[model samples]
Every structure is written in C-alpha cells, then in structure tokens.
Target: MPLLWKTSILLAISHDSNILPAHLQPLPSRGGHIRWNWIGDEHLNKTTDIIYMNASVAADGTLTGVSDFRATKFNGVTWLKTHAGREGVFAFKGPKAFMSIPGIVLPQDLKTFTFEASYAPQGAQNAELIRSGDFRIAWKGDTLSIQNGANTYQGSIPAVPAGQWVQLGCVVKEGIPSLFVNGKAVALLPGQSQPLTSIGNATLIGSGYTGMMDELRVWKEARPATRLGRDISPTWADRLLYFHLPADTKRSMGEDKASWASQIAWIRSRLRNPADHMVRLGIAGGAWKDMLRDPKARQKFAGEIASIVNRYKLDGVDLDFEWIEGPYKGDPPARQWDNYADLAQRIRKAQPDMCFTISLHVVCYRMPKKGIDAVDYFTFQNYGPSSARYPFDDFTRSLAAFRKQGFPDSKIMLSVPFQGTGDAKADSVRLYSDIVAQHPNLPPTADTAEFTYPDGTKRKMTFNGPATIRKKCEYAKAQKLRGIMYWDMGGDVRTDARKGQTDYRHPKALLPVINEILKGRR
Candidate 1:
C-alpha cells in the first residue's frame, strides 16, 4: 500500500573523521565514526544553528526526537549526538529521519482520498508488507474498498495462496485516479484535483494499511495504464444501499421515559421531516394498571400520557408492563389481559395515527392467541432466558416462532439485555446514586450468572467499550433487524456519572458512538 502522495523530511548527515583524538579508538572497526556533543549555557547563542541527532525537524524549526535518545537545549545547555556514515554505510538504529523540503510541491490538499484496488489477503495480522507511502493497501477478508466523499472504489483479484503476494496500485491525476490490480486497470474516479504539495511528515507505515501491499509508488506525474480504472463498481454500490430501523424506547421506564422523550425530541428537532424517522414512546403498562386501581389516578395518568404523546409528537407507544404480580400469573387472567387490551384500544382511539407496540416476556407467547393480536407490534424480551436454564438459542427460536406466527419483521423489536449478567441477581435494581458511589461494573458482563459466554468464559463484562458498541450497531444494520431496545437508560447514565467523578465531568463518550450509528439513519 502506498499513499497517493508521499511527504517526508530527509536528514543527510556527513562527517570526515580526521579530527578525532588519536587515543580514542573507534568501537569494533565500524565503517565510519563521528562524535558530537552539546552542552547548554546561560543563554543560547541565537547565531548558532541547533544541531539535532536522530530528530525530525518540524516546520517551526523545533526538533522532535524520533529515537529514544533525546534532550532539549535551554540557555546554552544542549543535547546532541554524533553521526557517522557515508550515503548508506553506518547502521541507523532508529526510525528513518528526514528533513522537510521548504517550498516543495504538494499533490493534494489535506482532503482524504479513497482508492480502489484488488482485494489481496494480508495474512493473519494483515500487516502491510509492501513498500508504499505512508498508506499501504491490504485486505482483511476477501474484499477491500477505499471511501472518501461521495465516491467509493473496490477491486478484486485472483485469490493469493498462502505465503504469496498480490500487486495492487492506484494513482490520481487531473481530478481522476486509476486503480490497477496485477498491472491491470480495474477502477477509476475523479480524484480531487489539487497542487502537488510536499509531504512534510514521516511516512506512517502499516498504521492505516490493513492488508499486504508491494511495489507501491507515487509519482509527481500520472502515468497511463493499459486498462482504464472506473468508479466503484455497480456491485459495490449495491452493497452500500442497505440500511437500520429506528431505536425502540419501549423499555425506558420511570424517569427513563422523559430521558427517551428528550432523546427523541433531540433527534426530531434535527430532522427536516420528523415523520420520516420512526419514533416509539414507552407507555408503562404498570402505570396503566395502577390507574385502574385508582380511577382518579387513571384519569391523571391518561392525561399525562396523552400530553406526553402530544408534546413529543410520538409516532407510536410501546406497552411495556413486566406484569410482575398481575392476574395473568398462576393462571390465565383473561380479565387482566382484557384491561391491558382495552388500554391499548383507548390509546389507539385517542391517537388513531400512532402505532402501538406491546412488549412481552417470551412466556407471553403462551398467552391466549387473541390477546397477542391486539397490539400492532410485538416486542419480545429475549434476555434472561438463562434464568430458566433455557439456552440462548432457545430464546432466539422463541422470537423466531413469533415471526412464524405471522409477526412481520418490521413489527418486531428484539430487546437485548443492557445488563449483561447472566445471573438474575445482577439485574436487581440499584439506585443511580448508589451506582455512582460504589461504581460497580454493570451489564454486558462477560462472565456471571446473568451472562453466559458462547465459549463458556465466566468473566463479568460490561457492554463493550464504545468501539465495540459501534460495531454492534453496524452489525445490527447489516442484519436488518427492526431496531435495538435496552431495558433502561438509568443504568447507563449512572455509569457515566461514576466515570465523571474522576474526570470532573460526565463523558460524552457514548453519545458519539450512538450518533455515529444514527448517522444518515436520522
């Protein structure tokens, strides 16, 4: 892999060894020897140029040590080392050093470039083995692509056998770049036309390059290839066309409803047409039941729910009542289920346009068939099946069974456990303040009774760091799942509070990852 343009600072050290002390012998007959040392004074002599050893000089004349040995010169004090060698004689012990060429040509502005090249496997670690610019072309699986702006480029080549290499090259000229795989042109696009600027920094090798790259080159002038490279192939464009559903806020409970409503409002405010994005509000079925017990409370709750729906302009409401001590328990409570159904009917009558979703435990699948038909969408809390000694596969199959029973994919939201503990006790409710004080690692536990690992590792794990969460969101998009809904927002907010204690402020770490996932999906 080679960057489309290369920039570097090359330092040429020259020394003639006749001025050495006669008694001071060279070590082990090395090819050449030069010794230079510097000390400081009360004040530096501005007239004397500072000598740097194994340092990369920045644009400001500041010497940045690229090697382990480095010190600064203050007043008259200095740190310097001797250099001895002809063009390529002395063995260099550190990174290659370079000197910036003032007023050199620049090929492109600071804009990012995406090039298309044949996907070639870069082996296990996917290290870049080719001599390219700061960038190297390497493959991870079977394919690779470079993306920038509105353009994307991709290429394919004969699969390289293990221990073999593949040749891939791309060059930009006149607002267009051509990609060559095995010396044949495969893709091309209008490369942003710009001046050929001097690459003033050391080439970062294998940093951005993923796969294997060899024989990489960059030229001030564009060279013609035997084949014409085109834009991202139609196949690649088709792959990018896929898309994620709106996030479901069904499990947001108590104060969580307000937080979720705020989140939805925040998202809604940014959209040109809020209706374009799906918004699901959570209606506490427990609250509704409490209202039934107290008629006055029912009226107040109904008014509050209606106000919330109007205030947030919600698209739908997800009925999430755990039904912990309801009549539906022990034996089928047709009356209790009827009350719940009637509440849904009332809300639907009030907001005819709004969608209604009912969240149920997997056991709800055993409810009378008519009870299941009342809600517009069915959300299955697929978590916690392990409590019954049921395999995760079994839980997944139960959700699949709903689909088999005429539930549309769009009408189903899978509720994943935010609390990753396979242990039921781990999900035991804790106040936000308590979590802030104790700072227990919560959820997505790697090992615990609440969480069971595929490989049987028993380590408790939190949801993966932000990077892993972003990857999971991407996977969700790829899988075309309806959307992801977690049990509650308080736990996550509390986790951030604990982190904020040490840092003096709550970190916006999770927001960025979430926003990235929501990009364009809005």
Candidate 2:
C-alpha cells in the first residue's frame, strides 16, 4: 500500500443513471494472482469485474483470482520466494516459460493506451515481455522495442540496465507513443494510425524473457507522462488488468487485491453534491529544493504544479517537503528551510484559487514564518516518538510545540495514525486493519496489540483503534482545531472478513468513528 494523507473524508451521491458504474469500467490489464473482493448488495454482480491495481500471489500454489478471469502458468514458469517482508517474485526458468491470461481486450481505437511492468533480467538477451494479438513489447538486448504491425520502432527507449529491477512503460497518447523508464520519459516513436488490438486477444507474459516480472498493468488511456512510473501502487481505474506476482510475507502494507479506483469512482458517482468532498494531490521530493532555489525554475515549476491542479480539476495541493532540514546527499545548504518556504510561496502565488496545505514534523518549528503563513492549514505528524514517546502525551506535546512556533490554531489539524508504531521491533508499521483482523475480540479501547511468532518471539503493536481514534477526533474538536488528519484510508479496518483481504468499508472502520466524533452520525 502507498501512503497518502487526508485532512477529512466526506461523502456525496451521484444521480445520473447513464454513467457506467465504476466497477463495471473495463480494465484490460495483467498482474499477479491476488483478488480484490467487494461487499454490498449493489456490488455483488460488479465485484467479478473489479480492476485491482496492487498485486500479490497465493502461497498455496493455487491461482486464486477475485476476477472471473484466471492466469495459467506454462512451460516451467516458477515462483521464486524472496526474503521475508517482500512479495514472492516470479522466475522464468527458460525461454519457453511464460504466463498466459485470457480476456485482455485493448481498445478498438488504439489511439491512446499504456503498458507497463517491473522486471529484473537474469542476463542480457532479446526477450519478449508482453505479446498479444499484433502487439509485441520486447527487449532487443538492452533496448526496449515495440512491434505493432508496421508501426514499429527499436532503441527509442534508453538501454535498460541488466540485473536490476527496472520499471518500464509505453504510453501511447493521442496517436504518439512514448517510452518511460523509471518514471522518466526516455523516448518516443512516430504516431500509429491502426488499431492496437487483435481479434484473439489473449496476453502472454514473459516468453523468452528469462527474468522475473511483477506489478504488471495495462490501461486503455495513456497514463499521464508526468504521473507514470512514480508510485508502485498506482490506482487501478481504467486499466484492464493489474497483478502483483508474489505472496504476502507479513509486511505492513496489505495486498492490492481491491479496486481502490473503482470504489472511489462508484462513491463519487453516487455523491449527492460533489462539493462536499475533495481530492488533493500531495507534492514532495528532494529535487524540489534545487528547483525552488533558482528563481527561473521556481516560477516555471510552480506553474507546472498549477497546471496539474487545474488540468485534473483537483481541489487542492498538499506540500509534503520531507527533507526540509536537509543537507540532502551531503550537498551544500545544510538547512534548506528557506527553500521550502520559498516553494510554498511560489506554488501559492501560482495556484491561489486551489487550497494549499503542508505536512510537517515537530522538527519544523524552525521553518521560516513566511513559509508557515503561505498555506491554508498545517498537519502535524504527531504520532511518533520524536514528537513524544507516550501516546496521548505525544499528541498534546506535539501540538504545543507547533503552537509555540506560531502556527495558527484555526489552520492546525491534529494527526492520527491508523497504523501501529513499531513498538514490537516490527520492521514496518502495522496496519490497523491487520491488527483488528488478527484480534477480532480485542477491546476497542486497547491501543496496543501483541503477537507471538512461530519462533516464540513476542511483539506488540501500538495503534489507534476505533475508541482511540474517536477520542482524538473529540480532542481536536474540543481544541477548536481545523480538523483531524490520518495517513491513509487504506489502513483502517475496512472489511469484516478475517482473511486480511478486500477493501469494503466495515461499520467498525476508523473513519466512521472519526466521523461520528467529529460530524455526528448522519
């Protein structure tokens, strides 16, 4: 699961019957064998068609798919288990080894589309990574090539380094085809006029590619070049198929079996008033300091940010400068606090109509007041030890620290963690969903849950349960704060099933608790 922050969760209803329901939206893509299960009478029939973005495999060797379609392994394509906390990767034993999937239909127009995957080559060789109908995505030695009828090209994409996990994507938007490697657009080919689909559209993955392929996805729409290849867990909405080629290994992030994009689309389609809810894109990166340090680049970058905000019709932008106190990579400027402030000011100037907010740790008290005043609100990262070791004390002390630093009370949003802190020497934070799934009868007020492993090692996870989350919401309301904030919607206990799968909203979920405390039940 990818980490996203939100100040609030609001609902709306869509009235139009003409719109295709979100779950019914076509996703002709491919990935691992994990399934995304949906709960609710309205979704029972649509669940079979849901498109999942995250990928995970079943450990029992049985291909368990939530969708009606299935993946068939052919010619010695085997599973390779990796170290604990990582998904089990697929191993292509020889040239003939591959995985075949039926029912992946590319758009008839083929004017725009995207095909992408993650692969680690055992050695350099000409290999076909994806083949279906007349479309062929292959690697001619280190160069990625595509052969779709006569509209074909080779070496347009930069040479892919051998023996490393590289994410490769081909995005054909508006008749022009571009190649993206590791999130950056590397090459482009002449436009094609023919349909990209074939009559018999079964997809074969990894014939002649003697390597591991994972996190595969195909989409009818060309993914935004600026947005592709950035996050491993991009939402699956218009995609045809999505698969993660490995099994869970007790990691903090759960499987990407559910169609988050479809769920959101369905929710949005049913909204009574769209203005009641909003979606903000979070922006953060180390390279941002350099862009902001120079005046010319800063203005241009700010404009680009605004373009994204306006073009997508996003409600706002959230600034998450993680390296505010940095001599990043031991570069010059030991503290880039001023640069961070400048960035906020620049983006604010560019996109004044859109809401602007920033997320900061307690160490950011020293950030210039100029930067502090540029945004609409401030979200304090109040759940961790550097803020305070004790739970309730941490919240209060962290707020006081920011208050002392002069952040306005009305613009302050208190933070809550749906995932547990690593009190049990856990390698990663434990999701609230996993905690409740493992301990269904655990007390709602109990903020800590301990588990014993097979080796008799005991570890305790500290997190906010329904009771704790409610208390925090109430506290924020009492303090007259702007609102409460949480790291993600994915971490809350959203399903009733105990298999630790699916993405449906359960009654005991944390968001509902927050809603009850903050807004009163509808």
Judged by lDDT, which candidate is best? 2
Worst window of 10 by summed lDDT in candidate 1 = 2-11
Model 1, global lDDT: 0.33
> How does model 2 fare in lDDT?
0.54
lDDT of 1 by residue, 326-360 (tens): 46324345555555555555555556676555666
Per-residue lDDT tens digits for candidate 2, residues 1-522, read 111123211110011111111111111233211233222322222111121222211222111222322354466566656622236666676577777766443444556777777777777656778776667777767676776656876555545555567778888776556788887867555444345556375767787878776656666577876655454331344334433323333231113323332333444454454454454444444355555556666666677668756765666655555545646555444346676677679889999988677767766545678887887767666555221332776777777887887887776776776567645443435556667777888887888778543456667667777777777767777777766666443455645433333343565566556545554541
Which number leads on TM-score?
Answer: 2
Candidate 1 Cα misplacement greater than 4 A, ranges: 1-281, 285-304, 324-331, 365-374, 384-395, 404-406, 422-481, 488-522
What TM-score does each of the candidates earn?
A: 0.34, 0.53
